[model samples]
Target: MTGVSLGFIPEPLLVALDHILPSRRLPSTVFDSRKFRQIKASIEEIGLIEPLSVTAMDQATGNYVLLDGHVRLLVMQNLGLVDAVCLVATDDESYTYNNRLNRLSTIQEHIMICRAVDRGISPERLAKALAIDITSILKKLSLLKGICTEAAELLGDRQFSSDLSRVLRKMKPTRQVECVELMVAANNVTVAYAEALLVATPVARLVEGKKPARLAGISPEQMARMESEMGNLQAQYRLVEQTYGQDVLNLVLAKGYLAKLLENESVTRHLQQHYPDLLTEFGVVVETVSLDRRHFAETT
Candidate 1:
C-alpha cells in the first residue's frame, strides 16, 4: 500500500469569522501596534490579499479552526466583517503553515511595486493598499534605479534596508558588485556597514569624481589606507569563504569526537593531569560550534 498524500485543499470557501475560532490568543498589546493599524488599513483597502488558513473542526460540522492569519482575522473582526475566505486543510497541522512561510524581502518588495506600477496601478492606490505614505512608495519604486543589475539580483531575496541601495548607487558597477558580495557573505546588510564600504571606496570608483562632504571623519590619506586594507581583507575573506563550509564540518566532527572522549572518565582525567591547558582548550572548542569564535580557546 502507498502512503497517503495530504495537503491543504486548493479550493477556498467563504467561512464566517464567528464559526472559525482562533487556536491561540494574541497579546492585547498587539492591537495597539503600528503594524496592526497598517494591517487593518490594508484589509480595508484591498479586501484581504491573502486568505486565512483553516481546518474543519469536525467531519460533519462545517465549523472550522483557524490555522493561520490571526492578525488578519482580528482586523476583519474589528471592521465588523462577518466572513472571510479561507484555505481548508485536510489535516490540522497548523504549525508548519505558520512557521514555514517566507516574508517578502526589501528588493523583492521593490520589484513587486515596480511591476504593479508598470501594470498601471498608481502609486496612490499602492500607498492606500499598503497603508504607507506615498513618499515611502516612491522610495521603494526608486530602489534599484542606479544599482547595477548584478548587485540588485544578489540582494533580491535579502531583507536589507532601502538606504543601503542608496549607498551602493554612489559606487561604480564593479565596486557595487564587490560591496554586495561582501554584505551577503557577512550576512550584514545594514546602512552603517554599507556606509563603511562606501567610505573605503576609492575616489576613482565613486560615481562622482569628488569626495563627499558627509564623510568628514575620514581624511583623504585615511580613506586611501582604508581602501588598501579593505582590498586585502576582501582577498582574505574570499579565501576563507572557499573553505568555510568544509572547515565548519571538520570542526563539528572534531568537537563531537572530543566530547565523546571526554565522556570517558579515565581519558578526561589523563588529559587533565598530563595536559591541563590542552584539555581546557579542547573543552572550550567543544562548547562552541562556530569556528569564527575559536578565539575563546586562546582567550581562556
Candidate 2:
C-alpha cells in the first residue's frame, strides 16, 4: 500500500502492527509486550475509544513503521489486528517530534530543558519562551548536560533545597547519598557547605565503628528507622556528568570559607558582627583573614 503524509494530528491514528516498531533498529530496550497485553486487554475490552498515536513510515522492507505507539501496535499485533490507520511521517521527523519541546514536571522539565540547551537553544531564548528565571531555565537545562536525572529530581523538589545542586554537582553519583547523609548529620551544615566538601573530598569522615555518638541527637535505633531516606536512587538512574551540580555552587563555595572561619573564636566573632548571626545564616562562620594565622604564617 502507498503511504502519504498526515499533519498536526487533530486525531490519533494507527499503523499496522508489524510496521509500528523500529524494524531494522529496535531500541535496545522497550516497553515489554506482557505489559502491553494488559493494556490491550483493557483497551480491547473497552474498545479503543482513545486512539493510539502513530506515524506511518514507508520503508523498503515493508510499508509502514510506528513512531510512538509501539505498545498499542504490539497489543494489536497480538490480537491479530493489522491494517491500522495512521498518519504518515519519516523516521527522522518522529525522532525530534517524540522528544521535542513540551510541558514537563519540575524534574521532567529539567530533562527537556537540558535537551533543548544541548541542542543549542540559547539560555536567553529558552528563558524568554518559558517565562521563568533565566538562572532557573539554565539550571533545569543543566540537568541533561550537568547532573544525572536521578540527582536532578532530588534537587528540583522544593523541600530538597537548591543547596543539593551543589552537592550533586561536586560529588560523584556513587558518593551523593553519603554526602547527603553527612550534610544532614553535620553540626554545622548547609547545601553550600556540604557542596564544598563534596567538591574537595570524596566522602565526609564519619566516625568509624559506630560508638559514643549519634547524629543530630537521634539514637542509632531511631536513625535506622529512616534508612531508606538516606538510600541512593535506583541504579537505572543515569548521572552522566562530573560537573553535575552548578546552580548554587557559589553558595557551596562561600560556605566552605564560612565553615573554615568558624573554627576560631576571633574569626567567628568577626563573621557574626559583619554577617549578622553568621553561624545561623551560613550554618558556620567566617574569618577576617584569608586563612588561619598559624597556617598562614607556616605557609608563608
Candidate 3:
C-alpha cells in the first residue's frame, strides 16, 4: 500500500473554541486525576504548550472536529477560554495521536526541565506548573549530575525513577555502566534493583572506595558471595547484549516456522496422537511470545 499524507498544510491556526467539537468523552473522575490536575495547572501557568489537533468540519461551516487534546479542551472549557491555537489536520484520523502516544522519558523530562530553567523559568513556577513539589523540581534538575554518559544514554528513553540516579551516583562509572546494562537486559529499572546493584558492587568500584553498608540479618560473607555472583551475572549479561538483536530475530523466525509446522494437518494429527504433551507445549509457544516455560523462560 502507498503512504498517504496527513494533516492540514502543516501550520497552526487560531480557532474559536465553539467551532471545535470534542470527539471523545472525558471521564467524570478526570478532574480528580493527577494527570488532569497537572494539565489544568500547566495550562493555567504556561497557557497550553501543546496545541489541540483538529480538522475542518466543512468548507463553509466554520467548524472543526477535535482530533486530539480532549483533556486540554475540557480544561480550557472549565477555564472559560473562548479560543484556542489548534493544528488543523487535513485528515480526520486521530488514531496516531491518541493511541500511539509517547510520553517523555525520565532523562528527556530532565533535559526539558533544565532547558526551561535555563530560559529563566524558576523552580517554584515550574513546580507549580507541573503540580509537583519544589524539591522534586530540584531533584530532577540534578538528576544526571553523576551518571556516566553511557548509562545515561542507555536509560534515556526508559521510564525509570529519578531515585535510581541517586543510587547510581555512588558507584564508579564502569560499574554503573554494568549495572545499567544488566537493568536494561532484565527490563527492570526499579530502585530496588539499583539498591541491589549497589550492594553487590565491589568496594573498589565504589566512588569513595568504601564498601556498601551491610543490611540487617545479612552477614559480610553473604554480601561477598552476592558480589561474586553479580560479577558473573554482569559477564553473562554482556554476552547476551552482544547478540540480543540476532537472538530476537532467530527466536521470531523459529516461532514462525514452528507455527507453520504445527498448522499442517499431518503434523497436527501425529503430534496429537503420539506426542500430545509436546503438542501442548508447542501450541503454547505458537500462541504466546513468552520464553517462560522452556530453559529461556525463567524470569529475571
Candidate 4:
C-alpha cells in the first residue's frame, strides 16, 4: 500500500510577519468590511484560532508566500503582531489551498460552539472570541434543540436562522422533514417560507396536534384553502421529481436526433420551405444547451 501524500508540513513553523508575503492583494474596501472588523476583534480578544498557510521559505529572500489567511495576516499587522505560526505547504500552489475550503454552515457552527462549551468555555468568552453578541452564541448553541435528526441532517449545510428552526419545532417530525424538503427544493429556505409551510400544515401534523395561529388578514377559510393548495403543489412537485431524470434523458435523446436530422440539407430545406416555424423550433431544441433546456422543461 502507498502512503497518502500530505500537502502541508505536520509541524507549524513560527515565522516573522515581515518575512511572510501575501500571494494576492486584497481590495482596499475589505479593510473596512465587517468581516475584517470581526477578525481583528476576535484576535484582539482571544488570539488567532487558525494558523496561516504558507509555502516553504524561499532560500533567496528567506520569505514564505502566504497561501491562505490573508484576512488574518492583515489583522495581525493591524494589531502590531511581529511573529505568527504558519503551516508550510509542500508546494506553492495556493489554488489547491483555497479551492478545497469549506465555509462553516449553521449546524457546523452549532456543533463547534457545543464542543467549546463542553470544554468549559463560557458563552461570554465565545461571544468575545467570535466578535458576536452572547445571545447569538446561545442561539447557535441551541440551534438544533427541537429539530429531528432527519430534518437537521437535511439542513446541515444550509445557513438559516434560529427562528427557522423554531418554526420547524412547531411541527411533528414527519411534517418537519416534508417542510424542509419543500423549502430546500424551492431554494427558498427563509423563515418566511418556513412560516408559510407551517401555516399550511394540517392540525394533526403539528407538534401538539394544535391548530396554527391565523395570520392577521387570513381567515380560517383562507387558511384551509391554502392548506389544500399547498398539498396539491407538494404532490405535483414530487411527481415532477420522480420523472425529472427520465424526462432529461428523453430530451437529450430527442435533441441528439434532431441535431443529426438538421445536419441533412434535404430535410432542412423541406422544413424551411413548408414548415418554417417547426424548423425554427427544431433549431432551438438542437442549439439549446442542456442546462438551459432543463430549465425550460422545468418551468414549462
- TM-scores for all candidates: the values are 0.84, 0.27, 0.85, 0.81
> So what's the TM-score on candidate 2?
0.27
Better candidate number, 2 or 4, judged by lDDT: 4
| lDDT of each residue in 80-114, candidate 2, tens digit only | 77756555543345552345324334555566666
Error of 3 at 16 (Å): 1.3
lDDT of 4 by residue, 152-204 (tens): 99998888887898899999998899899999888888999999898898888
What's the distance in Å from true for residue 10, model 3?
3.1
Best by lDDT: 4
Overall lDDT per candidate, in order of appearance = 0.85, 0.50, 0.85, 0.88
Per-candidate clashes come to 0, 5, 4, 0
**Model 4 misplacement above 4 A:** 1-14, 24-33, 87-100, 211-217, 259-274, 286-289, 292-300
State how far residue 115 of model 3 sits from its true place (Å): 1.0
Stronger candidate by TM-score (3 vs 4) = 3
Q: Which consecutive 10 residues in model 3 have the weakest lDDT in total? A: 291-300
Error of 3 at 255 (Å): 3.1
Better of 2 and 3 by TM-score: 3
What is the model-wide C-alpha lDDT for candidate 2? 0.50
Q: Name model 3 segments beyond 4 Å from true.
A: 1-9, 25-36, 94-96, 212-217, 288-300
Backbone collision tally, model 4:
0
